[model samples]
Target: MSLLLSPFDMAGTPLTNRVVMAPMTRARALDDIPDDHTVLYYRQRASAGLIISEGIPISREGCGYLFNPGLYSDEQALAWRRVTDEVHAKCGRIFAQLWHVGRMSHVSIQPGQAAPVSSVAVVAERSNAYAWVEPGKAGPVQASTPRALSIDEIQRISGDFVSAARRAMDAGFDGIELHGANGYLFEQFINGALNTRDDRYGGSIANRQRFLLDTLDALAATIGAEKVAVRISPFGRLFDMQPYGDEAETWISLAAALSARNLAYVHLSDQLTIGAEAIPQGFASQFRKAFRGTLMAAGGFNRTTAETALAEGELDLIAFGRPFIANPDLVERMRHDWPLAEGDRATFYGVNGAVTRGYTDYPAYQADASL
Candidate 1:
């Protein structure tokens, strides 16, 4: 089989191929349960070796976007079950990326009628922010500031995480991907500028990484590390997170901690960006070497560049986001070296399925060629 078509062991779970579907938030789930449209979406993209579902908040407070699903409720799990069943029927393997936007959320989106929590009170400052922002509408905009979470408060959030992971299993998801990247709560704690606590959870890089280590251990104990993966955009600049400290040191320490637990794999996203050179190649490579499990590199991956990363041993698998959005049969296309259709950027986020309508509607190479 070709590299794109080859099957391999992803942390002991045998996958059918190497191409991975990066998680792209469609926000189409109805009432936090995946609807029929959602079911069709995953089933259509079953050709990939693996699929990381859009971020599902562990608790209501963890959510940042409207209509984004939550793993904390039984209804949500049941809704996901239908979607997962369809994907499995098509011979697809899927994982849910557990999420908690922390400070990135607004009070309207927060749970328990309170402010959004984070490592600090700093809000995002974006000169160029993009995302969906209306009734089924999607686009880009600036970020908002969030409240700081106390140490005691963080412990409660940990319990929420465990509950969410269980919900993922209940939804019949094959595994769970902890959203520890992109200036979310976990990243806020890891990054110095966002973390100012002088107590146990702060002080140094090791101290900052402590929260993640403890959380991962607790989570691994619940579902086992083989079924758990953590994604980190070490050099990522999103969610209004402040940049401080030597970029190299923070990520090296962060990777070592995840590796120590022997996770399924570590996904380094920012390294694959188109023009920006935020996450350093050497930094990501260090984690690839430190981590003995599996290494998946995502963000802006196409055929040539993806293959080059794989050939260099920098990654064991490659995940595509926008490509998957436009090319549901991405693995097949890459296998045969077929050209990919560009996604309709205007519909990336919104209701009435405008974005999702064109989302999985693109025809595969073989199907389109016949036409």
Candidate 2:
């Protein structure tokens, strides 16, 4: 049997296959609550062995996108329960990705129009944030300069993560995945160029890792270590992330930390986006060596590449982002070697209340395509 099609146990959860639907933000939720559209969007992709939901802000302060969902409130958790129930009814396992945008946000998305908070007071250049100051005016806006978070604020934010994890469990999610990648709050804290703080949460690698480590420990305590997972983009410069000299050491060290905790998996968000550089050829092998747990690699993986990676044992599982977006039945399509549909770029994020157009409206493969 092809390794990609084989069933495996992810931590303690049994998976039907090795295909993972990588998380992508659709921004369909309003008032930080998941709606019916959100439920259908995830239900359509229930065939994936695992589905990681898009970045969910832990609090109002954690929000960056206008319509992105949150987990800090009972209403939001109740709304999410519908999503989790539908996915589970369809025999799918899903994880919520806890997120905070940090300095990559505009004032409009911040509480009371306050400055976005980060490890350092840095302004990301050439970055656009989704801010809805006025209901119809929500689109790409310049990222605002952020204020450095004090130790008290840092502890508060970490507590927010714990609360979100507990809320995820209450909402019936199978597990929770920490959004520690792609130039978000956690990544900002780890990047030396972005984190210029002199306290326990910055400076040396150990210090830089304190926030993430502490959060992970807290989440593990709240939701069990076996159900915790994290995603990281080691050399990512997205959202105006500056290159750091200790990139390799920082990421490898973080991986070791995750391994020591025996989390479900460590998701590597490699250079998979358009025009992004792929991680150096042997880096995955090196990462797998240092981290002795399941490793899921995301970013532009096709069936052949994913199979090869799994067969060679470089990765325990493979995550498909764009493919899953275009083809809800991505696993079945890949299994049958069927040509996949392409998702509309315009609708990838959302257009007015037409979020369902590009989300749940994609059709599955039909026999006519082969003729």
Candidate 3:
């Protein structure tokens, strides 16, 4: 029986515990450089067994939002080196989530005045497709339909991801996790509604999942599978509810292919959403049985729910997003059943100043907190 807050073995790396500091993009990396403030923000929460940074763009064309940290440039690499060094000094392991926004980006943000690219041209409901938002703004400027990527372009982007992985390793980080979910570039290729092509990269389940699979192959070859992980959202109408119609088959085949690699871990995005009900009882459990490697879950999981999932053999680790964002010492809080800090919706994203005022300023449990 694995506990949500106990030490566990993942990819042969032992951790202080199973509690992981889930990644949330705070848009804090202004000018693509992590300042002294960035160093303190991460060090404030360096106690998690594992910490994954917000999605870091892998190429210039891959920059989906402004202020989003990147790894493709020399300066960005230098900044990340500082972050990794701090986390390591505290004995904490961290992984960088390499990202590419693809069609989910604005023409103004991409290269050569080019529109955002995708496997198909299908658009989604209200989207967040522009470059990074300024300090205080709601709707982003409308993004144009991206030009479909050619095979040569795809190859180029693949190489970009490979290089980014190398940079992550060079930055003194423990590992890297491919952001293959949440309707991002790799995911756009996985979902059918957005991918209506007849090429080797689109159509059938295997074809739709081709880009991710190939990327995994390249990543495993470039960085040992033991140093690589992948994040996937199996449940949820996320990113415009485009799960390729036959999502189950897609996941089945996708998980099976990844299992073949025996990577570091496979973190599933199946936890409950704000308005969505609990997941059907045994679905994730079944998927865990299906996968032959380390498994984790994220998205709104409380201690009991997480324990149940882990107890049922559905997950080996759990990733808590919003909670960890508000409470840097979440593991300590959870252990003592301490109440959580109610995160301010207003300050969840956007310009955060030096104090990490909204970033790492969440107060720990106080003796008189319970009025």
Best by lDDT: 2
User: Tens digits of per-residue lDDT for model 3 on 312-357?
Assistant: 7777888888887778788778877888877876666656444366
Clashes of 1: 9
C-alpha lDDT (0 to 100) for residue 304 of candidate 3: 90
Error of 3 at 347 (Å): 1.0
Across residues 247-267, which tens digit of lDDT does each residue of candidate 2 receive?
A: 888877777777899999999
Candidate 1: stretches off by over 4 Å: 127-144, 271-277, 352-356, 366-371
Clashes of each: 9, 0, 4
Q: For every candidate structure, what is the RMSD over all alpha carbons to the true structure, in angstroms? A: 2.7, 1.7, 2.8
Best by TM-score: 2
Model 2, position 67, has a per-residue lDDT of 85
The digit string of per-residue lDDT tens for model 1 on 75-150 reads 8898899988988998889999999877777654555547678787777665222233554554444445678777
TM-score of each: 0.92, 0.96, 0.92
